[model samples]
Target chain A: MARPTIADIAERVGVSKGAVSFALNGRPGVAEATRARILQVAKEMNWRPHSAARALGGARADAVGLVIARPASTLGVEPFFAQLLSGLQAGLSRQSVAMHLMIVEDVEAETEVYRDWASAHRVDGFIIVDLKVRDPRIEVLEELGVPSVVLGGPGRHGSLSSVWADDREAMLSVADYLAALGHRRLAHVAGLPEFHHTQRRMRALRDSSRRLGLAETVSTTTDFSDAEGAAATRALLSRARRPTAIVYDSDVMALAGLGVAGEMGVRVPDELSIVAFDDSVLTRIAHPAITALSRDTFAYGRRLAEVMLALIEEPERRRDVKTATPRLVVRESTAPPGAWQGD
Target chain B: MARPTIADIAERVGVSKGAVSFALNGRPGVAEATRARILQVAKEMNWRPHSAARALGGARADAVGLVIARPASTLGVEPFFAQLLSGLQAGLSRQSVAMHLMIVEDVEAETEVYRDWASAHRVDGFIIVDLKVRDPRIEVLEELGVPSVVLGGPGRHGSLSSVWADDREAMLSVADYLAALGHRRLAHVAGLPEFHHTQRRMRALRDSSRRLGLAETVSTTTDFSDAEGAAATRALLSRARRPTAIVYDSDVMALAGLGVAGEMGVRVPDELSIVAFDDSVLTRIAHPAITALSRDTFAYGRRLAEVMLALIEEPERRRDVKTATPRLVVRESTAPPGAWQGD
Candidate 1:
C-alpha cells in the first residue's frame, strides 16, 4: 500500500520539507500556527511515521520492552497475557512502536533484563505485567530511570503509572452474582497466591462474603494449572460440607473444574453452580458454557500501551488508567442451587 | 546472580584479557592452542555473551525475530503458538540470543515486517511459522537475503532451511490408529485450509484411507477457532452417513467438538470416537480426556530457534531439521465404533 509520506504532507501544506520536519518532530523552528497547519495536513494525508527512519534519525528507539517474569511453560497456558500482548502490539503498531517481549525465570532475572534494556537504551519504556505485592520491578525501573507503565494495580506501585482492571470490584460482582443465585456454601479456586491481583481478588471475595452475610465461603490457592485446578475442585468438593457453587480464577481452571464435575457425576447448576474469571473461547465452548467475569482484555492492553507511550513522551505527566470492573456474563453454568432437583 | 565475565575467564585461564576476547569473539589474533584453552575456560566460567554488548561490538544483532501473523483474539486461544514461543524463548535464552516477537494481521503485512526488520537489521534471522504452500514470504526473504528458518514444511519454500514435523506421517498414523479400531467411516475437521501442514495432513489422510481400504473419509476446514470447529463438527455429524470417528486439528477445537457432542446427547467413545491434534492441557482436562497426537512443542520451538541461529551464523548452511512424528496418546476419547451399543 502506498502510504502518505512526510514529503506528501509537506507538499499538501505548501511548506518546505525542513519546516514540515520541524513541525513533525515538535522542534522549535516551526511557528505554532504553521505547526498546527502541517499537522492537520499530515493527519488528512494519513502520514504515519516509520519507526526505522525515526530510529535512524536518533529521535526515538521507536520501541517498548515488556519482560514477563514467568517460566515459558507458565506463559504458554495463560491466554490473558497473550490477549493483552496482542492488544499492546495493535496499539503500539498504530504509533509504529515496536514491542520487545521477553520471558524470564523470576523477578531477579526480570530486574536484570530491565537493567540491561535501560543501560542499552534498547527500549524507550516498558510495560510491566504480573505485578507482585511490593513489586521489585518498580524500584529497579525507578533506579534505572526507565519510563514504565504497570499493567495491574490501583494499590502501591510507588508513583509509576498503571493500567488495571478493578480486580476487587470484579470479584465483588462475581460473589454478588453467585449469592443472588441462591447459593449458600461457596468455594473459590484462586490463582497464584503471590500475584497482586490474586491477593486483591481473594480479599474482595472474603470481604464481600462477610458484607453480604453469605452462609459459608472457602478459598484455595493454585498455580493456575489445569491439573491443579481440577485437584482444587476435587479437594473442595470432598470437604465435610460441600459448597453448592464454585468460582474459578481463570477460564481454563473453570473448564477443568467442569470436567472434574463430569467425572464425579455432579450435575452443573443442579447439584452445583460454576463461575469463572477471564472469559475466552474455553469458557464459551464448554458443555454448558461457563458464566464468567467478562472484560475487554484487548482494549485493556491497548490502553496500557497508550499509557506507556504517554509516560515515555510526557515524563512530567502521570496517568493512572483504571478499567471498569469486569461484568458477569451468565451463560449456562450458573443457576439457583438445586432448583432443578425441585422440578 | 552475578554471572562470570570475560575477565573472570581470563583470570581463571591465566591468559591475557585480549586473548580471551579474541577467542570469545572468534577473531584471528589468538593462537590455536591458546584459543582452545581460553574457550574451555570461558565455558567453565559460564561467560555467556551479552547481547547488547555484542551488538555494540559491531557483531550481528544477536537476536532472532519471530512474527506471528494472526489477530490477538486468535493468538490468545491457541495454546500451540504460545507453547511453541515458550520453547523458542527457552532455546534462544540458552545462547543469549534475544527473541524479537511481533504479531501481524496477514501474510502481506507479515512480509512487510520481514522487509522492515531486514532493512533495519533489527534481527539477525527469523523463525517463520504458519508456512503456506508457495509461501510469498520465501521469495521476500530470499530477495532481502535475510536468514530464516520456516517452522512447518517439507515442501516448496525456495530452498530456505526448515524445521518440520512429519505432518504426513502423523496423519497416516492417526488414520491407521482409527481404522484399526474398526472405524470404517471417518471425518477430519482440519484447521485453516491455506496452511501447508493442513494440506499435507489432508493428503496424508486421504492416501492412508485409500491404502487401508476404509469405507469412507470426509474432510472439512475451519479457521481454527472453537466456534468454527464446533460448526464443522455439527455439519459433519449431520451428513447422510455420519463418520463413526472424527479428527480435529487442535485441542481447543476438539474440546469444542466434545461440547457439541454433549449438547446432542452423543456419548464420546460410546456413540462417537474423537481424536485431536497438538495435545496440551486442554486435551488432558476434557471430560473423557481426548486422545491426541502428542509432541514436545516446547522442544520443537527450542529446536527452531537453534536452527535459526545456525542459519544466521552460517549463511552458507542449509539445515533442515525434521522433528519426530507426533505419536497418538490414547486417552478415554477413542474406542471401537458402537462398542457401547452392545452393552
Candidate 2:
C-alpha cells in the first residue's frame, strides 16, 4: 500500500506543486518534455491522480457523470452492455475518466438525471443506451449541452451521434440461414417489445421469413433471459408440430432452449434445429453446436468505445450510422430438416 | 426528447426553486405534505433532478467503484462477472447504487487507480476483485477508510472482508460425488497460479482427490477462460489413457471442453466425464447437459452485496468470512464410469 502522492513526486522532481498538478492534468502550460518527465516519475512512483480530484479543478470534479436510464437489473443481464463497457474501458484507460454509471428505472427519472449531473458537473457526458420509441434523454442531453453518444441506431432523436449493431440484418440473417436449411417453419424468441432494437429485429425476422416463403412464428418475452428463453422453448415444443428451427434474441434464452429440448426428449438439430444471435460459448458446448448469427462481442465493445471517443473528441462530427454485419457461424445445431418437420 | 426539468416542475407547482430542490434531495425541514405536493408536481411534469446536481455536497459521490486488472478483451467474454453483476444490481436496486467498473491492463495501473478514486472520492467504497498474492490494496483502503469488500476469499490482505464460495467444500463435494460414481482416475483443469482463489481451490481439489484414493491428475492454465479450457481438454484427451473425469475452474471452459470431446469423438461421462465450478449457462446447455457444482450465482451476488452493505454501515464491525456452499447439479453430463456414460 505504498501509494506515492503527487507531493512526494513534486518534492523529488524539484517542481512546484502547482506545476506538477498542471503537468499531471495535461494542461497546456507545461512543456512537453517536462510533462513527460513528470508522467514518467509518476509512473515509476505508481502515482495515479484521482478521478474525484481531477473533476474538482473546474468543470471536471469531485464527480464523473454519464447519462444512463434503464433498470439496473435489465442492463446487468444484457451481454451487450457488458461487452460495450469492456470496450468503453479500453478507450478510457488511456486517460483518467472515472465513470459514474446511473440506473434510472424509467423515462421520467432519465429526464432529471441529466440536469442534476450537469448542474453538479458530476459527469463528463452521457452514454445514452436503449434509445426508446420516444427517447427523451437525447433532448435532455442536447438542452443541457452535455457531450454524449447514442448507443443505438439512428432514431427520431435526430441530432445525436450513434453507435449501434444492425439488429435488422442480424435477424434477417438468422431467418435466411434457417430457411436455407430446408426448414419451412421457424420461430423467433424476441426481447421486450418496448425496446426499439427488439422491435426492429422482430420486424426484420418476420419480414425475412415472409420473403423466404417460410412459416414465421414469433413469440415475445419481457426479458432477454435464459429462464424466459426456456419457457418459450417449452411452449414451442409442446405444440403438436414444433418449428424445425427456433431463433432466440439472446444467448441466455438460446442456452435455455437446450434444456427444454432435453426435458421434452427432443434431439437438437435432428428434431429441433436451433439458431441464435450470439456466437458465445454457451451455444458451442451443446451437443451439435447451435448455428448462430455470430458477431464479435469484443469487437462490439471496441467499436462502441471508438464511437464514444469520436463523440468526446469531435462533438460536431456528423453522427454516423455505423453498422456491424452480424456474421453467421454455421455450427452443428442447424442441419437440413431431417426429422420432426411440420408439413 | 421533451425531457422535463426542475424549473418546469416548480413552475407547474408554483413553488420556490429551493423548496423543490430540498424536497427532491430528500432533505429535512420541508413540510411533509408540502414535500408530497412538490414530488407530485415533479412527477406530473416528468422532471428529473439532473445527476450532475448530485455533486453539490460531499466528496463521496453516489457511484460505487470496481477495478479489474484483467484485460478488457477478456473481461467482456467472462459470464461469471456478468452474472454476479446482475445479482449485485438486484441488491444495488434495493439501495440505488450505481457502479463505476474499470478494467485496467495491469496490477500497477490498477493500484494507482484505487489511489486516484479514493483520494477524489469517485466512489464511497469499492468492490475489490481478483485477489492476488501479497495484495497491497488492504492497507491503502484502510488508510483511506473506504468501504471495500474483496470478491475472492481472504488473501494476504488481513483486514478487508471478503465474499467467496467455499472452495474446499466444493472440491470435497465434487470428489465425493465422482468417487461414489466409481471414478478412480480424476483430473483437475485448474486456473491461473497467481489468482488467490485458484490456488486455494486447486490445493483443495488435489487434497480431496488424494483422500478419495483416486489417481489424481492436475493440469494448470494461466487463464480462467473458455479457450484455455478447451485447450486443456484437448491436451488431456490426446493422452493415450486420459483420466475418467476432468474438473474445470469455470463453466465456459467446460463448454469448450465439451467441444473438444466432439472433435475427438470422445464421449462425455463415459469417455471423459466433466464437472465444472461456477455454474452458468455454458455448462448448462451442453448436449449432455454438464452436471456441475451449482452455486446460485445470483444468490452469491446478493449475499456479496449484503456483506458489503454491512461493512459500509458499520466500518467498526469486525470483518467476517462468508462463504456459499456448492450443491451438486447432476445434469446429463455426469454418470458412473461406463454406466449411463456417453460412450
Per-model TM-score versus the true fold: 0.80, 0.81
Q: Residue-wise lDDT of candidate 1 within A1-343, one digit each (tens)? A: 2346678888888989999988988889988999999999877665656544554354566679887767777677777777877788888877867787777778888887787766555678888888888777888777667788888888677877888889898888888888887787889999888889889988998898898888788889999898899999998877767888999999889998998898788998788899999997678766688999998888888888789888888976887888878999999999888854321
**Which candidate achieves the best DockQ against the true structure?**
2
Report the lDDT tens digits of candidate 2 across residue range B25-134: 89987799989999988776556544333332443466678887877777656677777776775575467566776677677787767777765556767888778767
Lowest-lDDT window of 10 residues in candidate 1 chain B?
B50-59
DockQ of each: 0.22, 0.37
Identify the CAPRI category of the predicted complex in candidate 1.
Answer: incorrect
User: In model 2, what is the error at residue A21, expressed in angstroms?
Assistant: 9.4
Question: Which regions in candidate 2 have their CA more than 4 angstroms from the true location?
Answer: A1-57, A61-78, A176-183, A209-222, A234-244, A261-272, A338-343, B1-59, B217-221, B238-241, B338-343
Task: Report model 2's TM-score to 2 decimal places.
Answer: 0.81
TM-score of 1: 0.80
> Which candidate should be chosen as best, given TM-score against the real structure?
2
lDDT (C-alpha) at residue A264 in model 1: 89
Tens digits of per-residue lDDT for model 1 on B1-343? 2446678888888888888888998999988998999888777654667544554444576578777777766666688887888888887877766777776778888888887777555778888888987688888887778788988888677778999999888889999998888888889999888899999989988997889998888889999988899999888777767788899999988998998888778889888999999998778767788999999898898888888878877988998888899999999999999953332
lDDT of 2 by residue, A80-146 (tens): 5677677777766546565666566677776666676665566656677677777767777777776
